[model samples]
Target: MGSDNTDRNKPGIANFAALKTAIVNGEDQLVRELLSHEPMLDIEKSYLIDLAQLNKNHTIIKLLENISVKK
Candidate 1:
C-alpha cells in the first residue's frame, strides 16, 4: 500500500480572520502564536493593509512598509 500525505491541514478565511482580529486587537502574543503555527504567514500581504486602514495602525503599517522595502 502507498501512503499519500498531501493536502493536509490548510489555512482558510477563518484562520485569516482570527489572525486579523488578533492584530487589530493589538494582541501581539496571539499574533506571534498564530505565526508560530503558520510560519509562512505574511502580515503585509495579508490583512496588514486592511487592518491599518480600518484601525489606523500606523506602527503596523510602517513596520509592514519597512518589511516590504527590505524584501
Candidate 2:
C-alpha cells in the first residue's frame, strides 16, 4: 500500500491545529514551512491573517503577503 498524506492537502482541524500550534509555540521554522506549503491558510481564511497580526508574526504575515502577491 502507498502511504497517503492527502489529508495535508485539505484545510481542516488538523491543518488549522498545526498552524495554530506553530504560531502559539513561536515555532518560526514550522510556521514558515506550513505557510509555504499551504498559502491558502492565509488567503482563504482572514482569521489566520488576523491571528498573525495579533501575534505580531511579521514573518508569517510576509509569507501570506507573498502568497497574495503571487495570486
Candidate 3:
C-alpha cells in the first residue's frame, strides 16, 4: 500500500463517523489500518468504494476493492 501524508491531522477512528470521514478524505492506508483494528468493520458496511468512484479517486477505489469485507 502507498503512503498518503495528507492525513497528518486526523489521528484515529473513534467511531463510524470517523471511518466515514476517512473514506471521504481518501485515506487508504489509514482506513485499512483502522479496519484492521475495528471489529465492526465487517458487520457494518462502508460505502468507501462508492465514495471513491464518485470522487474519481482511482487509488482509493483500488484500495477499497482489495479489502474483503465479510458480512
Candidate 4:
C-alpha cells in the first residue's frame, strides 16, 4: 500500500487568513515557522510574495522566494 504523504505535508494553519495576517504584519519569524511547517502551491506562494512586496518586507519576500524555489 502507498503511504499518505499529502496529509503529512498539510500546513498547520487552519486557513490562509492567518498566513495573510502574518505576512501583512511583517511577522518574519512567524512566517518562517509557518512556511517551514508545510508546503504551499505556486499560486499561493505568488500571492504571499505579492503581499510581502506590498508591505515592503524584503526578508519575508526572500524567504518565500527561497521556499518557492526549494519546492
Stretches of candidate 2 off by over 4 Å are 1-11, 36-44, 68-71
lDDT tens digits, residue span 4-47, model 2: 55655456657677977777676778877776453454355576
The best candidate in terms of lDDT? 4
Provide the TM-score for each candidate, comma-separated.
0.44, 0.58, 0.51, 0.70
Show where candidate 3 strays beyond 4 Å.
1-15, 37-46
**Which numbered prediction scores highest in TM-score against the true structure?**
4
Please provide, for model 3 over 8-58, each residue's C-alpha lDDT reduced to its tens digit, 9 standing for 90 to 100: 424633555665677788777776665653333443454656776777778
Q: Rate the local accuracy (lDDT) of all candidates.
A: 0.55, 0.66, 0.62, 0.79
Rank ordering of all candidates by TM-score, starting from the highest: 4, 2, 3, 1
Residue-level lDDT of model 4, residues 19-71, one tens digit each, is 78999999999887777645678888898899999999999999888864325
lDDT of 1 by residue, 32-54 (tens): 55543223345444556577567
TM-score of 1: 0.44
Which candidate, 1 or 4, has the higher lDDT? 4
- In terms of TM-score, how similar is model 3 to the real structure? 0.51
What is the number of backbone collisions in each predicted candidate, taken in the order shown? 0, 0, 0, 0
Better of 3 and 4 by lDDT: 4
Which RMSD values do the candidates have, in order? 5.4, 4.9, 10.5, 4.3
